[model samples]
Target: MSQSKPEERLALELSCAICLQLYRDPVALPCGHNYCLGCIQNAASAEDPKSPKRCPECREEYGSLETLPKNFKLSSIVDGFLVATTGGGLRGGPTVPCDQCLDNPLAAVKFCTRCEMSLCPSHLKKHEERHRSLHVLVELPAERDGKRCPVHLKVTEYLCVQERLFLCSDCLMEGSHQHHEVQTFEVAKEEMKRVLEELGKSVSDKLQITEALVKSASEGPTDKAEDKLVARANILQNVQYVFSRFSTEITVSIAV
Candidate 1:
Protein backbone atom coordinates (compact mmCIF):
# COMPACT_ATOMS: atom_id res chain seq x y z
CA MET A 1 0.00 0.00 0.00
CA SER A 2 2.85 2.37 0.87
CA GLN A 3 4.62 1.84 -2.48
CA SER A 4 1.46 1.73 -4.59
CA LYS A 5 0.21 5.08 -3.26
CA PRO A 6 3.32 6.94 -4.44
CA GLU A 7 3.21 5.16 -7.80
CA GLU A 8 -0.38 6.27 -8.26
CA ARG A 9 0.64 9.89 -7.64
CA LEU A 10 3.56 9.53 -10.06
CA ALA A 11 1.18 8.12 -12.65
CA LEU A 12 -1.02 11.20 -12.23
CA GLU A 13 1.95 13.51 -12.72
CA LEU A 14 3.13 11.74 -15.88
CA SER A 15 -0.34 11.63 -17.45
CA CYS A 16 -1.14 14.15 -20.17
CA ALA A 17 -3.84 16.68 -19.25
CA ILE A 18 -5.53 16.15 -22.66
CA CYS A 19 -5.17 12.45 -23.40
CA LEU A 20 -5.10 11.41 -19.73
CA GLN A 21 -2.40 8.85 -20.49
CA LEU A 22 1.35 8.58 -20.04
CA TYR A 23 2.87 11.14 -22.36
CA ARG A 24 4.04 10.08 -25.81
CA ASP A 25 6.67 12.61 -26.83
CA PRO A 26 5.74 15.20 -24.23
CA VAL A 27 6.05 18.92 -24.95
CA ALA A 28 5.62 21.98 -22.74
CA LEU A 29 3.36 24.88 -23.71
CA PRO A 30 4.18 28.51 -22.96
CA CYS A 31 1.80 28.14 -20.01
CA GLY A 32 4.17 25.42 -18.66
CA HIS A 33 1.51 22.68 -18.89
CA ASN A 34 2.70 19.38 -20.37
CA TYR A 35 0.89 17.31 -22.97
CA CYS A 36 1.64 14.59 -25.48
CA LEU A 37 3.16 16.18 -28.58
CA GLY A 38 0.70 14.52 -30.96
CA CYS A 39 -2.24 15.40 -28.69
CA ILE A 40 -1.35 19.09 -28.58
CA GLN A 41 -0.49 19.17 -32.29
CA ASN A 42 -3.84 17.62 -33.20
CA ALA A 43 -5.60 20.20 -30.99
CA ALA A 44 -3.71 23.02 -32.72
CA SER A 45 -4.63 21.58 -36.11
CA ALA A 46 -8.31 21.48 -35.15
CA GLU A 47 -8.26 25.25 -34.59
CA ASP A 48 -7.31 28.20 -36.80
CA PRO A 49 -3.54 28.61 -36.82
CA LYS A 50 -3.77 32.41 -37.24
CA SER A 51 -5.73 32.70 -33.99
CA PRO A 52 -3.97 32.74 -30.63
CA LYS A 53 -3.18 29.18 -29.45
CA ARG A 54 -4.53 28.56 -25.96
CA CYS A 55 -3.47 25.69 -23.71
CA PRO A 56 -6.26 23.17 -23.14
CA GLU A 57 -5.57 23.02 -19.39
CA CYS A 58 -4.92 26.66 -18.47
CA ARG A 59 -6.30 28.49 -21.54
CA GLU A 60 -3.15 30.63 -21.66
CA GLU A 61 -2.46 31.92 -25.18
CA TYR A 62 0.70 31.38 -27.11
CA GLY A 63 1.78 32.36 -30.63
CA SER A 64 2.68 29.14 -32.47
CA LEU A 65 3.30 25.39 -32.12
CA GLU A 66 6.75 25.90 -33.60
CA THR A 67 7.85 27.64 -30.40
CA LEU A 68 6.59 24.92 -28.00
CA PRO A 69 9.50 23.18 -26.28
CA LYS A 70 9.76 19.39 -26.13
CA ASN A 71 10.10 18.32 -22.48
CA PHE A 72 13.06 15.96 -22.94
CA LYS A 73 13.75 15.72 -19.21
CA LEU A 74 10.11 14.83 -18.46
CA SER A 75 10.07 12.39 -21.38
CA SER A 76 13.13 10.65 -19.98
CA ILE A 77 11.52 10.50 -16.55
CA VAL A 78 8.37 8.99 -18.10
CA ASP A 79 10.45 6.26 -19.65
CA GLY A 80 12.06 5.44 -16.33
CA PHE A 81 8.72 5.60 -14.51
CA LEU A 82 7.13 3.18 -16.98
CA VAL A 83 10.02 0.80 -16.67
CA ALA A 84 9.97 0.92 -12.89
CA THR A 85 6.20 0.51 -12.57
CA THR A 86 5.81 -2.18 -15.21
CA GLY A 87 8.93 -4.13 -14.24
CA GLY A 88 11.11 -3.18 -17.25
CA GLY A 89 9.62 -5.29 -20.08
CA LEU A 90 5.89 -5.81 -19.62
CA ARG A 91 3.50 -2.98 -20.52
CA GLY A 92 1.33 -3.77 -17.47
CA GLY A 93 1.66 -5.12 -13.98
CA PRO A 94 1.40 -8.86 -13.24
CA THR A 95 -2.04 -10.35 -13.78
CA VAL A 96 -4.01 -11.41 -10.72
CA PRO A 97 -5.06 -15.04 -11.05
CA CYS A 98 -8.64 -16.12 -10.45
CA ASP A 99 -9.03 -17.10 -6.83
CA GLN A 100 -11.75 -19.60 -7.76
CA CYS A 101 -9.56 -21.61 -10.11
CA LEU A 102 -8.63 -25.01 -8.74
CA ASP A 103 -5.75 -25.71 -11.15
CA ASN A 104 -4.01 -23.81 -13.94
CA PRO A 105 -5.42 -20.58 -12.55
CA LEU A 106 -6.72 -18.26 -15.26
CA ALA A 107 -6.06 -14.53 -15.20
CA ALA A 108 -8.79 -12.58 -13.48
CA VAL A 109 -10.95 -10.21 -15.51
CA LYS A 110 -12.72 -8.69 -12.53
CA PHE A 111 -12.51 -8.51 -8.76
CA CYS A 112 -15.53 -8.96 -6.49
CA THR A 113 -14.86 -6.70 -3.54
CA ARG A 114 -17.66 -8.08 -1.39
CA CYS A 115 -16.45 -11.66 -1.94
CA GLU A 116 -12.81 -10.51 -1.64
CA MET A 117 -11.76 -12.65 -4.59
CA SER A 118 -10.47 -12.29 -8.12
CA LEU A 119 -12.70 -13.95 -10.74
CA CYS A 120 -12.42 -15.22 -14.29
CA PRO A 121 -15.29 -14.51 -16.70
CA SER A 122 -17.12 -17.73 -15.81
CA HIS A 123 -16.89 -17.07 -12.09
CA LEU A 124 -17.74 -13.40 -12.60
CA LYS A 125 -21.00 -14.31 -14.39
CA LYS A 126 -22.01 -16.62 -11.53
CA HIS A 127 -21.08 -13.90 -9.03
CA GLU A 128 -23.19 -11.37 -10.92
CA GLU A 129 -26.10 -13.79 -11.03
CA ARG A 130 -26.22 -14.52 -7.31
CA HIS A 131 -25.32 -11.12 -5.92
CA ARG A 132 -26.00 -8.64 -8.66
CA SER A 133 -27.58 -6.17 -6.27
CA LEU A 134 -25.06 -6.62 -3.46
CA HIS A 135 -21.66 -7.21 -5.03
CA VAL A 136 -19.24 -4.51 -6.14
CA LEU A 137 -17.27 -5.87 -9.06
CA VAL A 138 -14.47 -3.68 -10.41
CA GLU A 139 -12.13 -4.15 -13.33
CA LEU A 140 -9.04 -6.08 -12.39
CA PRO A 141 -5.66 -4.39 -11.87
CA ALA A 142 -7.03 -0.87 -12.40
CA GLU A 143 -8.48 -0.31 -8.95
CA ARG A 144 -5.77 -2.63 -7.64
CA ASP A 145 -7.57 -5.04 -5.27
CA GLY A 146 -10.32 -2.50 -4.55
CA LYS A 147 -10.06 0.45 -2.18
CA ARG A 148 -11.77 -0.63 1.03
CA CYS A 149 -11.62 0.83 4.50
CA PRO A 150 -9.56 -1.61 6.55
CA VAL A 151 -11.63 -1.12 9.68
CA HIS A 152 -15.13 -0.95 8.20
CA LEU A 153 -14.66 -3.24 5.16
CA LYS A 154 -16.65 -0.84 3.01
CA VAL A 155 -15.67 0.94 -0.21
CA THR A 156 -13.64 3.97 0.79
CA GLU A 157 -15.12 7.10 -0.75
CA TYR A 158 -13.63 9.76 1.47
CA LEU A 159 -10.14 10.90 2.44
CA CYS A 160 -9.29 11.72 6.06
CA VAL A 161 -6.70 14.45 5.67
CA GLN A 162 -5.53 14.36 9.29
CA GLU A 163 -4.80 10.63 9.16
CA ARG A 164 -3.56 10.73 5.56
CA LEU A 165 -5.81 7.80 4.62
CA PHE A 166 -9.01 6.91 2.86
CA LEU A 167 -12.33 6.50 4.73
CA CYS A 168 -15.67 4.90 4.08
CA SER A 169 -18.95 6.65 5.04
CA ASP A 170 -19.10 4.75 8.30
CA CYS A 171 -15.69 6.08 9.23
CA LEU A 172 -17.06 9.61 9.26
CA MET A 173 -19.79 8.53 11.69
CA GLU A 174 -18.19 5.99 14.05
CA GLY A 175 -14.58 5.24 13.11
CA SER A 176 -11.42 6.80 14.54
CA HIS A 177 -11.47 9.49 11.79
CA GLN A 178 -14.96 10.64 12.89
CA HIS A 179 -13.75 14.01 14.14
CA HIS A 180 -10.98 14.63 11.56
CA GLU A 181 -10.99 16.79 8.43
CA VAL A 182 -12.38 14.77 5.53
CA GLN A 183 -13.40 15.10 1.89
CA THR A 184 -14.74 12.91 -0.87
CA PHE A 185 -12.17 11.50 -3.30
CA GLU A 186 -13.77 13.52 -6.10
CA VAL A 187 -13.38 16.74 -4.14
CA ALA A 188 -9.78 15.93 -3.24
CA LYS A 189 -8.94 15.23 -6.87
CA GLU A 190 -10.48 18.53 -7.94
CA GLU A 191 -8.44 20.37 -5.32
CA MET A 192 -5.28 18.71 -6.61
CA LYS A 193 -6.20 19.71 -10.15
CA ARG A 194 -6.39 23.34 -9.04
CA VAL A 195 -3.02 22.99 -7.32
CA LEU A 196 -1.57 21.61 -10.55
CA GLU A 197 -3.00 24.56 -12.48
CA GLU A 198 -1.37 27.02 -10.10
CA LEU A 199 1.92 25.11 -10.36
CA GLY A 200 1.70 25.37 -14.15
CA LYS A 201 1.17 29.13 -13.95
CA SER A 202 4.12 29.52 -11.59
CA VAL A 203 6.36 27.53 -13.91
CA SER A 204 5.15 29.51 -16.88
CA ASP A 205 5.99 32.80 -15.19
CA LYS A 206 9.47 31.69 -14.19
CA LEU A 207 10.23 30.18 -17.60
CA GLN A 208 8.99 33.30 -19.37
CA ILE A 209 11.39 35.41 -17.33
CA THR A 210 14.25 33.04 -18.13
CA GLU A 211 13.31 32.97 -21.80
CA ALA A 212 13.19 36.76 -21.95
CA LEU A 213 16.64 36.99 -20.36
CA VAL A 214 18.07 34.47 -22.81
CA LYS A 215 16.50 36.28 -25.74
CA SER A 216 18.01 39.56 -24.54
CA ALA A 217 21.43 37.95 -24.16
CA SER A 218 21.21 36.32 -27.62
CA GLU A 219 20.38 39.65 -29.27
CA GLY A 220 23.56 41.31 -27.89
CA PRO A 221 27.27 40.41 -28.05
CA THR A 222 27.99 37.90 -25.20
CA ASP A 223 31.74 37.60 -25.66
CA LYS A 224 32.62 38.22 -21.98
CA ALA A 225 32.97 35.23 -19.54
CA GLU A 226 31.44 37.22 -16.62
CA ASP A 227 28.33 38.09 -18.65
CA LYS A 228 27.94 34.43 -19.71
CA LEU A 229 28.26 33.35 -16.04
CA VAL A 230 25.60 35.86 -14.95
CA ALA A 231 23.19 34.70 -17.68
CA ARG A 232 23.69 31.04 -16.68
CA ALA A 233 23.14 31.87 -13.01
CA ASN A 234 19.88 33.70 -13.71
CA ILE A 235 18.59 30.83 -15.84
CA LEU A 236 19.52 28.31 -13.13
CA GLN A 237 17.76 30.36 -10.47
CA ASN A 238 14.54 30.50 -12.49
CA VAL A 239 14.67 26.76 -13.15
CA GLN A 240 15.23 26.05 -9.45
CA TYR A 241 12.18 28.09 -8.53
CA VAL A 242 10.02 26.24 -11.08
CA PHE A 243 11.02 22.75 -9.88
CA SER A 244 10.90 23.66 -6.18
CA ARG A 245 7.32 24.83 -6.49
CA PHE A 246 6.43 21.76 -8.55
CA SER A 247 7.86 19.45 -5.87
CA THR A 248 6.05 21.20 -3.06
CA GLU A 249 2.67 21.14 -4.82
CA ILE A 250 3.00 17.49 -5.83
CA THR A 251 3.84 16.50 -2.26
CA VAL A 252 0.78 18.34 -1.00
CA SER A 253 -1.35 16.73 -3.74
CA ILE A 254 -0.22 13.21 -2.83
CA ALA A 255 -0.89 13.86 0.84
CA VAL A 256 -4.45 14.85 -0.02
Candidate 2:
Protein backbone atom coordinates (compact mmCIF):
# COMPACT_ATOMS: atom_id res chain seq x y z
CA MET A 1 0.00 0.00 0.00
CA SER A 2 2.87 2.38 0.77
CA GLN A 3 4.49 1.62 -2.59
CA SER A 4 1.14 2.08 -4.33
CA LYS A 5 0.76 5.48 -2.74
CA PRO A 6 4.09 6.68 -4.09
CA GLU A 7 3.30 5.41 -7.59
CA GLU A 8 -0.09 7.06 -7.45
CA ARG A 9 1.46 10.33 -6.38
CA LEU A 10 3.91 10.22 -9.27
CA ALA A 11 1.12 9.50 -11.79
CA LEU A 12 -1.07 12.33 -10.55
CA GLU A 13 1.87 14.69 -10.57
CA LEU A 14 2.39 14.08 -14.30
CA SER A 15 -1.18 13.83 -15.52
CA CYS A 16 -3.63 16.67 -16.24
CA ALA A 17 -7.29 16.33 -15.19
CA ILE A 18 -8.73 17.58 -18.48
CA CYS A 19 -6.52 16.19 -21.29
CA LEU A 20 -5.52 13.12 -19.26
CA GLN A 21 -2.10 13.54 -20.92
CA LEU A 22 -0.69 16.73 -19.45
CA TYR A 23 -1.99 20.21 -18.69
CA ARG A 24 -1.63 22.68 -21.53
CA ASP A 25 -4.08 25.41 -20.54
CA PRO A 26 -4.55 25.06 -16.77
CA VAL A 27 -7.38 26.92 -15.06
CA ALA A 28 -8.61 27.18 -11.48
CA LEU A 29 -12.33 26.86 -10.89
CA PRO A 30 -14.20 29.00 -8.37
CA CYS A 31 -14.40 25.91 -6.15
CA GLY A 32 -10.57 25.81 -5.98
CA HIS A 33 -10.43 22.90 -8.41
CA ASN A 34 -7.97 22.90 -11.30
CA TYR A 35 -8.75 21.41 -14.73
CA CYS A 36 -7.96 21.75 -18.43
CA LEU A 37 -10.24 24.18 -20.25
CA GLY A 38 -11.83 21.55 -22.51
CA CYS A 39 -12.25 18.96 -19.80
CA ILE A 40 -14.13 21.27 -17.43
CA GLN A 41 -16.37 22.56 -20.20
CA ASN A 42 -17.40 19.02 -21.10
CA ALA A 43 -18.00 18.09 -17.49
CA ALA A 44 -20.12 21.18 -16.93
CA SER A 45 -22.39 20.38 -19.89
CA ALA A 46 -23.18 16.73 -19.08
CA GLU A 47 -26.16 17.39 -16.80
CA ASP A 48 -29.58 18.71 -17.82
CA PRO A 49 -30.32 22.42 -17.26
CA LYS A 50 -32.91 21.49 -14.63
CA SER A 51 -30.13 20.01 -12.46
CA PRO A 52 -27.39 21.91 -10.71
CA LYS A 53 -23.87 22.03 -12.24
CA ARG A 54 -21.55 20.35 -9.81
CA CYS A 55 -18.07 18.94 -9.61
CA PRO A 56 -18.03 15.31 -10.76
CA GLU A 57 -15.96 13.93 -7.90
CA CYS A 58 -17.02 16.24 -5.05
CA ARG A 59 -20.52 16.94 -6.43
CA GLU A 60 -20.21 20.55 -5.23
CA GLU A 61 -22.71 22.71 -7.06
CA TYR A 62 -21.73 26.03 -8.73
CA GLY A 63 -25.05 27.76 -9.38
CA SER A 64 -23.82 30.21 -12.02
CA LEU A 65 -21.94 29.58 -15.28
CA GLU A 66 -18.81 31.66 -15.83
CA THR A 67 -15.85 30.90 -18.11
CA LEU A 68 -12.64 30.05 -16.26
CA PRO A 69 -9.57 32.28 -16.64
CA LYS A 70 -6.25 30.88 -17.91
CA ASN A 71 -3.41 30.32 -15.46
CA PHE A 72 -0.56 31.71 -17.56
CA LYS A 73 2.21 31.10 -15.03
CA LEU A 74 1.26 27.45 -14.57
CA SER A 75 0.96 26.98 -18.32
CA SER A 76 4.44 28.41 -18.89
CA ILE A 77 5.97 26.11 -16.30
CA VAL A 78 4.20 23.05 -17.69
CA ASP A 79 5.09 23.94 -21.26
CA GLY A 80 8.74 24.40 -20.33
CA PHE A 81 8.84 21.07 -18.49
CA LEU A 82 7.21 19.23 -21.37
CA VAL A 83 9.51 20.82 -23.90
CA ALA A 84 12.56 19.86 -21.90
CA THR A 85 11.37 16.28 -21.41
CA THR A 86 10.32 15.78 -25.06
CA GLY A 87 13.33 17.57 -26.59
CA GLY A 88 11.30 20.68 -27.56
CA GLY A 89 8.32 18.80 -28.94
CA LEU A 90 4.76 18.38 -27.58
CA ARG A 91 4.65 14.74 -28.65
CA GLY A 92 2.45 13.26 -25.92
CA GLY A 93 -0.02 14.82 -23.52
CA PRO A 94 1.00 16.29 -20.15
CA THR A 95 3.19 14.22 -17.90
CA VAL A 96 2.26 16.01 -14.67
CA PRO A 97 0.00 14.24 -12.25
CA CYS A 98 -3.30 15.51 -10.86
CA ASP A 99 -3.29 17.89 -7.89
CA GLN A 100 -6.54 16.67 -6.29
CA CYS A 101 -5.48 13.14 -5.37
CA LEU A 102 -2.39 11.01 -5.62
CA ASP A 103 -4.39 7.94 -6.77
CA ASN A 104 -6.20 7.26 -10.05
CA PRO A 105 -4.62 8.81 -13.14
CA LEU A 106 -6.66 11.40 -15.03
CA ALA A 107 -8.57 10.09 -18.08
CA ALA A 108 -10.26 11.47 -21.25
CA VAL A 109 -9.24 15.11 -21.16
CA LYS A 110 -10.66 17.84 -23.45
CA PHE A 111 -10.05 21.52 -24.23
CA CYS A 112 -11.88 24.28 -22.30
CA THR A 113 -12.79 27.57 -23.93
CA ARG A 114 -12.89 29.81 -20.87
CA CYS A 115 -9.90 28.28 -19.11
CA GLU A 116 -7.82 27.65 -22.25
CA MET A 117 -6.60 24.34 -20.84
CA SER A 118 -7.32 20.69 -21.51
CA LEU A 119 -9.97 19.15 -19.24
CA CYS A 120 -11.17 15.66 -18.59
CA PRO A 121 -13.89 14.69 -21.08
CA SER A 122 -16.52 14.40 -18.36
CA HIS A 123 -15.69 17.84 -16.98
CA LEU A 124 -15.69 19.37 -20.47
CA LYS A 125 -19.06 17.87 -21.35
CA LYS A 126 -20.61 19.28 -18.21
CA HIS A 127 -19.18 22.74 -18.97
CA GLU A 128 -20.56 22.65 -22.51
CA GLU A 129 -24.12 21.73 -21.53
CA ARG A 130 -24.31 24.18 -18.64
CA HIS A 131 -22.49 27.15 -20.14
CA ARG A 132 -24.01 26.66 -23.61
CA SER A 133 -21.97 28.98 -25.85
CA LEU A 134 -19.53 30.13 -23.17
CA HIS A 135 -17.01 27.42 -23.92
CA VAL A 136 -15.68 26.76 -27.42
CA LEU A 137 -13.64 23.79 -28.72
CA VAL A 138 -10.95 24.60 -31.26
CA GLU A 139 -9.49 22.18 -33.82
CA LEU A 140 -5.80 22.73 -34.42
CA PRO A 141 -4.04 21.48 -37.55
CA ALA A 142 -1.06 19.18 -37.24
CA GLU A 143 2.35 20.58 -38.13
CA ARG A 144 3.14 20.11 -41.83
CA ASP A 145 5.98 20.93 -44.20
CA GLY A 146 4.91 23.87 -46.34
CA LYS A 147 7.94 23.68 -48.62
CA ARG A 148 7.23 20.39 -50.35
CA CYS A 149 5.70 20.33 -53.87
CA PRO A 150 2.88 17.81 -54.09
CA VAL A 151 2.84 17.27 -57.85
CA HIS A 152 6.55 16.78 -58.29
CA LEU A 153 8.64 14.25 -56.43
CA LYS A 154 11.52 16.66 -56.10
CA VAL A 155 11.84 19.43 -53.51
CA THR A 156 10.95 22.95 -54.57
CA GLU A 157 14.06 24.37 -56.31
CA TYR A 158 12.75 27.44 -58.12
CA LEU A 159 10.50 30.38 -57.37
CA CYS A 160 8.20 31.94 -59.97
CA VAL A 161 8.75 35.68 -59.71
CA GLN A 162 5.54 36.44 -61.60
CA GLU A 163 3.29 33.71 -60.16
CA ARG A 164 4.83 33.98 -56.69
CA LEU A 165 5.01 30.23 -56.00
CA PHE A 166 7.67 27.71 -55.14
CA LEU A 167 8.07 25.14 -57.92
CA CYS A 168 10.28 22.25 -58.77
CA SER A 169 12.93 23.03 -61.41
CA ASP A 170 11.24 20.81 -63.97
CA CYS A 171 7.85 22.42 -63.40
CA LEU A 172 9.37 25.89 -63.76
CA MET A 173 10.96 25.01 -67.08
CA GLU A 174 7.93 23.20 -68.53
CA GLY A 175 4.61 24.32 -67.12
CA SER A 176 5.13 27.65 -65.32
CA HIS A 177 7.70 29.05 -67.78
CA GLN A 178 5.27 30.56 -70.31
CA HIS A 179 3.90 33.33 -68.05
CA HIS A 180 6.33 33.53 -65.14
CA GLU A 181 9.87 34.74 -64.71
CA VAL A 182 11.88 31.93 -63.18
CA GLN A 183 14.69 32.63 -60.73
CA THR A 184 17.38 30.13 -59.85
CA PHE A 185 17.71 28.90 -56.30
CA GLU A 186 20.93 30.83 -55.72
CA VAL A 187 19.59 33.99 -57.38
CA ALA A 188 16.46 33.93 -55.28
CA LYS A 189 18.52 33.67 -52.11
CA GLU A 190 20.66 36.62 -53.23
CA GLU A 191 17.56 38.66 -54.00
CA MET A 192 16.26 38.02 -50.50
CA LYS A 193 19.56 39.26 -49.05
CA ARG A 194 19.38 42.39 -51.17
CA VAL A 195 15.81 43.04 -50.06
CA LEU A 196 16.80 42.66 -46.42
CA GLU A 197 19.70 45.10 -46.87
CA GLU A 198 17.39 47.67 -48.47
CA LEU A 199 14.90 47.29 -45.63
CA GLY A 200 17.66 47.76 -43.09
CA LYS A 201 18.77 50.98 -44.78
CA SER A 202 15.21 52.26 -44.82
CA VAL A 203 14.86 51.59 -41.12
CA SER A 204 18.15 53.32 -40.41
CA ASP A 205 17.02 56.38 -42.37
CA LYS A 206 13.82 56.60 -40.36
CA LEU A 207 15.75 56.31 -37.13
CA GLN A 208 18.05 59.15 -38.21
CA ILE A 209 15.07 61.36 -38.95
CA THR A 210 13.63 60.62 -35.53
CA GLU A 211 16.94 61.49 -33.88
CA ALA A 212 17.09 64.80 -35.77
CA LEU A 213 13.60 65.72 -34.66
CA VAL A 214 14.44 64.96 -31.02
CA LYS A 215 17.60 67.07 -31.26
CA SER A 216 15.65 69.97 -32.73
CA ALA A 217 13.11 69.74 -29.91
CA SER A 218 15.86 69.81 -27.29
CA GLU A 219 17.38 72.98 -28.83
CA GLY A 220 14.13 74.91 -28.52
CA PRO A 221 14.60 75.79 -24.81
CA THR A 222 18.23 76.84 -25.37
CA ASP A 223 17.16 79.11 -28.20
CA LYS A 224 14.61 80.79 -25.94
CA ALA A 225 17.21 81.35 -23.20
CA GLU A 226 19.63 82.95 -25.74
CA ASP A 227 16.93 85.32 -26.94
CA LYS A 228 16.13 86.38 -23.36
CA LEU A 229 19.81 87.08 -22.62
CA VAL A 230 20.15 89.22 -25.73
CA ALA A 231 17.07 91.27 -24.80
CA ARG A 232 18.39 91.88 -21.23
CA ALA A 233 21.80 93.07 -22.59
CA ASN A 234 20.04 95.54 -24.92
CA ILE A 235 18.03 96.97 -22.01
CA LEU A 236 21.20 97.41 -19.85
CA GLN A 237 23.00 99.18 -22.71
CA ASN A 238 20.10 101.64 -23.12
CA VAL A 239 20.10 102.39 -19.33
CA GLN A 240 23.91 103.02 -19.35
CA TYR A 241 23.54 105.45 -22.31
CA VAL A 242 20.75 107.36 -20.54
CA PHE A 243 22.89 107.66 -17.35
CA SER A 244 25.95 108.89 -19.36
CA ARG A 245 23.84 111.62 -21.07
CA PHE A 246 22.37 112.76 -17.75
CA SER A 247 25.92 112.99 -16.17
CA THR A 248 27.19 115.05 -19.14
CA GLU A 249 24.30 117.52 -18.75
CA ILE A 250 24.91 117.88 -14.98
CA THR A 251 28.72 118.43 -15.55
CA VAL A 252 27.92 121.27 -18.04
CA SER A 253 25.50 122.91 -15.56
CA ILE A 254 28.12 122.80 -12.74
CA ALA A 255 30.86 124.34 -15.04
CA VAL A 256 28.49 127.25 -16.02
Best by TM-score: 1
Tens-place lDDT digits, model 1, residues 1-256: 1223465567667777775556767888877898888889889899876788898878899767778888999988976775664443123444555567553343455677788887754455556667765888776656554565656555678988777798877888985777788988999899889988888898888889888887777676756768877887878887887798799878878777
Question: How close is every model to the real structure, measured as TM-score?
Answer: 0.41, 0.32
lDDT of 2 by residue, 63-160 (tens): 55565677777677665554543334333442322112222333323344455443333344445566767677543212121244545433477777
Q: Tell me, by lDDT, which candidate is best.
A: 1
Candidate 2 is scored at a TM of 0.32
**For candidate 2, which ten residues in a row score worst on lDDT?**
94-103
Model 2 misplaced stretches (Cα beyond 4 Å): 1-11, 63-65, 91-256
lDDT of candidate 1 at residue 252, scale 0 to 100 = 78
Candidate 2 RMSD to the correct structure: 23.7
